[model samples]
Target: MRSPTARTAPPTRTPLATGWGTRVLVVLAAGGVAVLVLPLVALLAATPWRDLPALVADPAVLQALRLSLLTAGSATLVALVLGVPLAWLLARDDLRGAWLLRALVTVPLVLPPVVGGVALLLLLGRRGLLGSSLDAWFGLTVPFTSVAVVLAQVFVALPFLVLSVEGALRGADRRRALVAQTLGASPAYVLRRVTLPAVAPGVAAGAALCFTRALGEFGATVTFAGSFPGTTRTMPLAVYLAMDSAPEQAVAMSVLLLGLSVAVLVVMRGRWVGGLPGARPPRSGQDAR
Candidate 1:
C-alpha cells in the first residue's frame, strides 16, 4: 500500500497547463494593450523627425513650454503643501464622513475639465460671489491670468496626490509611530520624523503624477485662464492651437509631451510598484532564503 504522505501528495502542474479560461484572458489582455499602445505608436510614426528641432525651437512653442513647466511645478508644490494634511485626515479611521470627504476629493478626477473651469470661473471671476468681495476689497481679479492656470492645474492635480498619499498612509505599518508617541514624542515630532519618511515613496509618486497631469491640462486652462501666449498658454493649449494652424508643430508638441510623460513613468516605476496599494515590495535575498 502507498504511504500516507504519497497518498496525500497533489499532482504537479506545468506552467503550460493553463486551460481555455486562461487563454481567453490572455487574448483579452493583448487586445487591451493594443488599444492603449497603437495611438502612441501612430503618433511617433507620424512625427516629422527632421523638422522636430525647428518646430520645438519656435518662439511660441518655447513660451508654452516655459509656461507649462512653471505652472505644473507650482501646482505640484501647492498640492504637496495642502494635500498631505488632507490625505492624513482622510486616512484616519476615526474621522467622520471620510467616505463623503474622499468622494468629494476625487470628484475632479471624473468631472469634466470644462465643468471645473466653469465652476472656477463662477467662484473667482471678477464679478463672481467671493471674487466680487476680493475685487471690492483688494482690487484683484483671478480669471484669465497665469495665476488662473496654476489654480486650474491645482484643482485637477490635487486629487492625485491626496489619493496616493492616503493609500500609502493606509498601507504603512504604524508601529514605530505609535511607539514614538508612547515614548512621549510630540505628535508633530512623530508625524514629521516617523510617518512622513515611511510614506515618502508614495509622496514622490503622487507628485510625479500631479506634475504630469498638470502638464497635460487643457480645457480648464483654456476656459478659465485663456490662451494668452507667454502668460497662460501651456503646451497642451499650444498643441491644440497648432493642430489648426500647424499640424507638424502639433505633432512635435505631442511627441515632446509624450516623452516627458514617459520619463516620469520610467523614473517612478519602482516607487509605484513598491509603494502603491496592492503591490508587495520585492524581498531581499536573505528573505527569500
Candidate 2:
C-alpha cells in the first residue's frame, strides 16, 4: 500500500489570472456603481420628510400620478401588442432590410424627446397634412390632449420593448422549435405554446422598461400634450410646474420618480437574470415551454 501510494501522482491545482488589468477593471466597475448610487442617496438626504406627505397629497400631485399611471400603462400595452410581433419578425424572419428596420426603430431613442414631440406635431397636429383631413372628417385633434401624451410615450417606449424581446428570441434555441414543429405543431401553435413561454420573461422586462420610460417622459409630453392639469399633466410635468412655485414638492416628486426607477430596475434585473444568460435549460427532456 505504501509503494502504490508513492507511485500515484499528486493532485493538480488550477491558477487564476490576477493581473493588474483585472484589478483595474474591478475598481472601475465599483466606481461606476458608486457614481450611479450617489445621486439617489443625495436626493433622499435632501428630502424634507416633514412636508413630503402634504406635498404628495396635493390634488395636483394626485392628478399627475393618476394620469401618469394611466398613460404609462396604456403605452406599455401598446408597445406589447405591436412590439412582440416586430421582435418576432426581426428575430425569426430573413427579411432583406431587417437591419435598416431595426435602426429606424431605435431612432427615437437617440432623438431628443422634444424633437420627437415636434415631429409628432408636424404629423398629427390639427394643421398637419394628415391632421387636416382627420379634423375635417372626424373632428379629431390629437395634440394638447391626453391622447397626445399616450402617443408620445408610446413612440419613445416601443424601442425598449422590441429590442428586449428580440434579444430573447435570438438567444432561444430555434432547433428546439423545429423539433416541436416536426412533432405536429403548427407554426402558430409553436409560437403560442413554445416560443412565447420561453421568452415571456424578456417580455415582462421589456414592458417594465416601457412603463418606466413612459412614466418619466417629459419633453414630448409637455411639448405635444401641453401639460394641462388633471388631463395631460403627469409626474414629470408636475415636477416642472412645481419647480417655480414649490421646490420642495418638486424634490418630493423627483424622489418618488427615483424610487419607481429603482423598483423597476430591481424587478427587471431579477427577471432578466432568471430568463436569459443565467437561465438554465430545462432539466428534463421536455423543452422550456
Highest-scoring model, TM-score: 1
Question: In candidate 2, residue 94 scores what lDDT?
Answer: 68
Candidate 1 ranges beyond 4 A from true positions: 1-17, 286-289
lDDT of each: 0.91, 0.87
Shift in Å, residue 141, candidate 2: 0.5
- Please, what is the TM-score per model? 0.92, 0.86
Q: Give model 2's TM-score versus the native structure.
A: 0.86
Q: Would you give me the overall lDDT of model 2?
A: 0.87
Q: Which numbered prediction scores highest in lDDT against the true structure?
A: 1
TM-score of 1: 0.92
